[model samples]
Target: MAPHERACFYVQAQAPQEKLAFYFAVQSGGNFDIDYEVTNPAGGVVLDGQKERQGDFVFAARSAGEHAFCFSNTMSSFAEKMLDFDVTAEHETQADHPSRQNPLPNAAKQREQAAQSLSTIDEMASRIATGLTNFHRSLRHYHTRLHRNMDTVRSTESRVFWFAVMEVAFITGVVGAQIMAIQTLFNTSGKARV
Candidate 1:
């Protein structure tokens, strides 16, 4: 992101009351902070913040349409920032409904009961998949941070090593010059006495 620049993204909700999960983290640059805003389809602000490092939020849609999520780097004059973010729009499934817990007794439709059980199993599988995806993202983010820190440490170590070498060379040169000057004075004094 550039100074005074804003980036906006849109997420669509197909039905009313859908859940929207928003998450973002500043990976690097400019103090690892940014300004963020989330607006609903009606242009109403759902959430907003300034100079934030990261955020995790979940909200239900008031009406079906597109929602906007924005990030701003206006606070920084020369530093650019990088961000990792995700927006998930999830619809409520029938299998997840509370009323589905107790269905009316009907012996005529044994196949329907079996189908409902399958759907329940499918929902569980989907939930597991989502969890795995989130876990993978976290792992990647941490790996990036670790790699950056390692590079910084290596650079610092190299600079320190070179500085120590230069200091040793400088000291050696100064000592050699002093010894030559003292030797010249002693030779001159001895010659004059002879």
Candidate 2:
């Protein structure tokens, strides 16, 4: 960086005594030759390695630090070119597990959960109201359509009844004419026509 110190501290967390990976960086042209040293609070170098240009190194952390990752630019004639770069470390993920803590009492949490459930019920009530209203409207429409069909059926039945009555009257008139004609034929043959 453009800072005067030119070196900053990095905090990497890993599982206890497990293998750890570190990504180290330095400026170009060898002005910044970077190195990393893992240590305990007892001021010991657990692991140390010189950083390569455009490279990375992985090592296990024997103990947690106060790990020193140092970058030196004085090793190059173009120290300005090799100023400062970046380093990163990746840790293996076992799971997204939070440490155990004191849990809240059931009374308070139950009240909060119940309150949330009540809000959900309220939302369902509104939806049910709308649904029932729609159902009622559909029912009314069906009833109206049924009434119209029944009226049409009644009108058809009335027409059929009138046609049947007219047919019965026509048949009765024909029978009466036949009987009268027979009687007249017999009477005229015997005497006069009536």
Candidate 3:
């Protein structure tokens, strides 16, 4: 691809340590995997993974190029399945790019600074989305485990409640029997004295 063709105006200065990532879709006509290998123009491997399941094939691009990205789905073990994928080049400007490099309408030299500002906001939104996804996954895993143990706890509570009920009944019975015996003794003594 040309310089500007594949090179989307990315927030490089702000996120210096962050790499450019693209989500790819993989589909197989047979029981195989579209295992992918992403390499730079220099043949250096940037990423290598198999899209075994239906999920984001996330990767990072260091520099611009028709970066030799490849995928394979030819396993001999499983029945031929189907796969579909899309390469969504992310980490670049989604809403901000024009104003940073080129000027928008009405402005000649100073491209409306909206591009950079909007890109910053875009970066924030992206981070928030990622964070929320992670939090949600963690919450799901935690809830699953919590509920798994909760059944045992519920059964334990039932046993404890039943034990408490039996103890209460026993105590009440003993107290009533003692009261009846004391009344009988008083009546018998009074009658004998009469």
Which residue pairs of candidate 2 clash? Answer: 31-73
Which residue ranges in model 3 land beyond 4 Å of their true spot? 1-20, 24-32, 54-59, 77-79, 91-194
Candidate 1 has a TM-score of 0.68
Best by the TM-score measure: 1
62, model 3: CA deviation in Å? 1.7
Off by over 4 Å in 2: 1-115, 190-194
lDDT (tens digit, per residue) of candidate 1 on 69-186: 9999988999888788889998775544433455556643665666688788887988998899789778866865775576567778999999999999999999999999889878
TM-score of each: 0.68, 0.37, 0.33
Give the Cα lDDT of each candidate: 0.84, 0.53, 0.53
Report how far off residue 76 is in candidate 2 (Å): 99
Steric clash pairs (candidate 1): none
For model 3, the run of ten residues with the poorest summed lDDT: 1-10
Clash tally for model 1? 0
